[model samples]
Target chain A: MPSHDRRLIGAALVLLCGVAAADTVYVTLEKDDAIAVIDGATGIRTRTARIGKRPRGIALAKDGKNLYVAASDSDAIQVIDAGTLNVTGTLPAGKDPETFAMDPDDRFLYVSNEDDGRVTVIDIAARKAVKEIPVGIEPEGIAVSPDGRWVVSTSETTNMAHWIDRAKLEVVDNTLVDPRPRAATFTADSRQLWVSSEIAGTVTVIDTETRQPLKTISFKIAGVTPEKVQPVGIRIDPARRYAYVALGPANRVAVVDAQKLEVKDYLLVGQRVWNLEFSPDFGRLYTTNGLSNDVSIIDLASHKVTKSVAVGSHPWGVAVRP
Target chain B: MTPALALKLLIRFNRLSACAGRILLSSGIVALALFQAAALGGPAPVRRQTPAPVAAPQAVERLTLAYLGQLAEAAAVRPYFEPVVADRGVQGARLGLVDDNTTGRFTRQEFALAETRLAPGDDAEAAFKRLVADGRRFILVDLKPEVLRRLAALPQAHDVLLLDVSSRDDALRGGDCASNVLHLLPSRAMRADALSQYLAKKKWTRWFLAVGPAPEDRLFADALKRSAKRFGMKIVAEKTWTHSFDDRKTPESEVPVFTQGSDYDLVLVADEAGSFGDILSYRTWLPRPVAGTQGLVPSAWHHTLEAWGAIQLQNRFRQQAGRWMTEADYGAWLAVRAIGEAATRTRSLEFEAIRSYLLSDGFALAGFKGVPLSFRRWDGQLRQPVLLVQERSLVAVAPVEGFAHPKNELDSLGYDEPETSCRAKP
Candidate 1:
């Protein structure tokens, strides 16, 4: 059926949508405990696959064959076959997996066990937890460098990012940031890391080489209240030129000049935008609006919210791939 | 969210500047340095030599904050639905130490909260002296307004920093306000104002006010009346309850009769004791929403508040305390974090430096309420957004849209600069 569905999707790509633009947008509905699959070409939700308890983080595989979701309450990573949209397998993620990052080789996934105050490194092929790294409490934002040399875990209560050396699997350094750091993202070359502090309304750009913060960028939208400006999910583009940040509750995605280290523009999205993902071509950005219960598709070319696809309740995390 | 559970990361601390030699930090009597380290039983922080570019460590400074609270004399009867949590407010102060230590790990600072709860007939003056002698100037207090006033008047408490965590008496922030103490929890007036804003937003302008027999209930009712007037809401029907309707017995019949004559958009019950608010919620004759002490209550913390990074604190508190964090606990937590923020922002251990920085306009505490909570220079009241919550869901956060002030929107909640008689500053 998986192979049959892949052939149908391939046929649909050629018959309806173009090959390069046939990106499948998968959004995890936190409240609904389901993944809403949308056809990127039309910005329309095609399927709703019921997966796991409290599904938040959704990551697409390298070959675009599987989608791994962090089912927090289930304490397991539910893997879904991309073609069939069926849960194929499970990976042992520790208690309450908030989010995770896949290594460059896609061999491992560093999952943040929020309640456990540890990051469980899962071996994809083995389907087992390989190592547990003790971090600060309420560890939320997790990232693995594209080179697979470093893994960064940002702890909310600790207000520090514990830098894990990929080789040694040991925490070598810690950088203090603003209070309640929610999410962290590394640039394409993995030279720079952007961390969003939810409470402080600021994002600290860390220098990956020196393991130090380069600049603390504070956000202030003209009409938005300062308290409402909470930065959560951050993602840099394929070109690594512009970084997009989901400002929680403010309902705006901040466009940051990654090279220049400045907030270029703010694309107004939906209420309580938690996480976002860039499409295969990086031509569009999909934001999971938690409160709005919708997926806002941002046309990257125009930097405007082009379409809002209602994906049911609490759309938390989004991922797209060809 | 929380500190690490120490696993092989044993951080050996060289107390660079130990202020107190021998001090009873806790009832268990922990070593001054290991107070917070052992209390949380979280991983001992491992400090690296490489310093971060921004907010780097100045030097390893040992600081201690103390908790001063009074045990409730009479066992307060909570309705059958509520679970009784002992050591409620103190747990919040304890969590604050854990939180401070989280930042303390990177800041090269160690923090401890000396807990002292006054039981029946305990000497407040002697306990205050002991904390002061132990170099514990910053104390988070959850006491009655009168008890707080008595402690602040003590000669030894002159230079000490006392944070009022629980007392919601507006008079304490007004005439009875002390320059030494900073109010972390919002006053009754502020809570009423927070609720009024939400009511105004919803156009629930007509209120059926129900007041319990308790003295605190009356005070809360007073606040509700004031807020109603301020928000341009009409108290169409006001009633005082003197009837002793046992919660075990059928209040269904009694409550409807009591509320039958009233026609209002919302039922505002000011019952400080969990006396009859629950009984009034669904049993109201009009089937209108009940707010205030029971239904959609305005509070510092709620079990349902998972937004604006509050989930981190909620998760941490549940993991550590094995219970939900209460409003009193949230107040205590904020006081401790305020101390840490003040200390970290100024980067000094000097009493005046920390105290002034706390009161200064520059000092802002990220209270996980989607805002930077700061002290009102006029009344020493911590300005913060109030949470309006129901049983299992967060309804709204107050200082609701369009409820604005020329200076600070949070100032619009409680007594403003001109409205207050407390002149903390010249």
Candidate 2:
């Protein structure tokens, strides 16, 4: 074979791989009733899809072919096609669907109906609610375990984290946490669950096996008062090495060493930061700032906020395509 | 004494004795009936005759609260300043009852508010006795200090929990403190201190103090003086305004003259009524900012506040009342919400249970403020964030960034435990 032909084949293979690895970031602009898509490499918004009224929570499908958003005011889950960025269908959800979590296999979606005090379980393919499990009052945070065996819903007013058995669709245990729990996340190993309490200014860690609180991590900055250090949205890295917590009025993200369970640093971000997401390689973190109406991107290696990109009014939820 | 007066006094004493005797008898009968039911494992006849259904609905617990106030004439202010409703306190209590019921529907609890408005010169003591006689244990009082003290001292009010939602006099929480009374309104000192904190943070240390002629204005001025000292501010000059100005007559010519001979960073007015304070803002002698009762006033609730889910509450109140919420309304609402929170947490509507739960350390009510509001153990005053608001916008919130306390930061805006003169009776 000719050497020029071999070089041309190598170039073609590299182009194909680059196209396959293309990434896009989706953010829910809560007040604008739209979801913005940003090009991952350039950090520029490429497209926006108007989904529904008060779009709050966003999650991508396992295959990265579709996006699901919890439209709180509309009380439905809007399904969007990733390729065209258009609303393809709507799934029946409970009253005031605020936040949700999808199973690892993308077969089922668990939603928190804040006003009705119930968790609606939906079959993704059928686009209908399968079961309504009653939880505590003002349920806002919803999470499913990595092993797809358990689901947790945190209620704001009732101050309880209810653990639901996935297969049975029943509440198996209830763990009381600090006041006004807003968000929850499960560790990669499925051994521990972390819930953030906005009014209590703490993150409660619970053991999945025993279903008991293992530790409570409180955040305190040198110049900020304790009441202002509200923990709202939390994200644990894929490797489970670090936990990033968005402190709502403090305008800072707390970096917690997950292994040691200690707060190592506070990265200054935009005002009223609430939700957080990470890049596919865990090299960058994105936080949605509700008050400042922007998103802050932080470089994971240096622990610094690299840039702040302006979005719509009250950006709340974010999802990244892998 | 004259024979006729002596005879009248004797008749009144006999009537009082008869009323007390009747109350004692009714309470004794209720206690006996409760004991009989408990002893028989239920109310005897029904339980013995038929077995109740396994899925019988549980008896819903009902919480009754009362709002008592005197129907005094509205303040003689300009027509533009007229309130939408003459009965502000009762409206707040009614809205609070609705909010409680909204949460209660899910908790198997119900709440009802009983409103009683007295005519001018009517006997508040008699009206309060009537409410207690009707078995209302929680009462929200919007009466004057003297009337409230009289009601609080009545023997029939010993078991009742009174929430004062209108009076801002510190004396009620200090020298005249009552064992059964809890204060929801921010005291004069708290408001003054809140303003002083914001002013100090802005570095507006020099103040020109202007006071009105009324006694309430004098009291407010005294509170401002104390706050200035506490916050390390200096009063550069002082004056007393003895003139009155109407809307038709502008203060453009006289205000500058009245505020002359002062080099100050800001002007602090102590006008309790809406007399001349509004005229001092842009008409100050010096090109300075104005604060206190006129310009940047400190209040418990303002329409400008839209944070911490307050917009939802404001919208609800507007829909129900068809007007903006006032400070008195917010105070009354907070009082009722405190009771609702206590009942929901303990799952019991018993008076003693709710009272003890409210006084416990675990009791904190989210009052749409940024932080959880709890009563100060020293004086039974609700500790909360005070907002510094202009006419159209929220300027800032109190307990400003650098103002720290050993315990809660809200303590910085009011009397601390050490400084509190209230020897609260247990």
What lDDT score is found at residue B320 in candidate 2?
Answer: 72
Residue pairs clashing in model 2 are: none
Candidate 1 Cα misplacement greater than 4 A, ranges: A1-20, B1-60, B75-84, B243-262, B276-289, B309-312, B345-348, B360-366, B390-393, B401-412
Ten-residue segment with the worst summed lDDT in candidate 2 chain B? B11-20
DockQ of predictions, in order shown: 0.21, 0.08
DockQ, candidate no. 1:
0.21
Q: Which 10 consecutive positions of candidate 1 chain A have the poorest summed lDDT?
A: A11-20
Q: What's each prediction's TM-score?
A: 0.85, 0.74
Supply the global lDDT for candidate 1. 0.80
How well is each residue in B388-408 modelled by candidate 2, as lDDT tens digits?
999899999987878888778
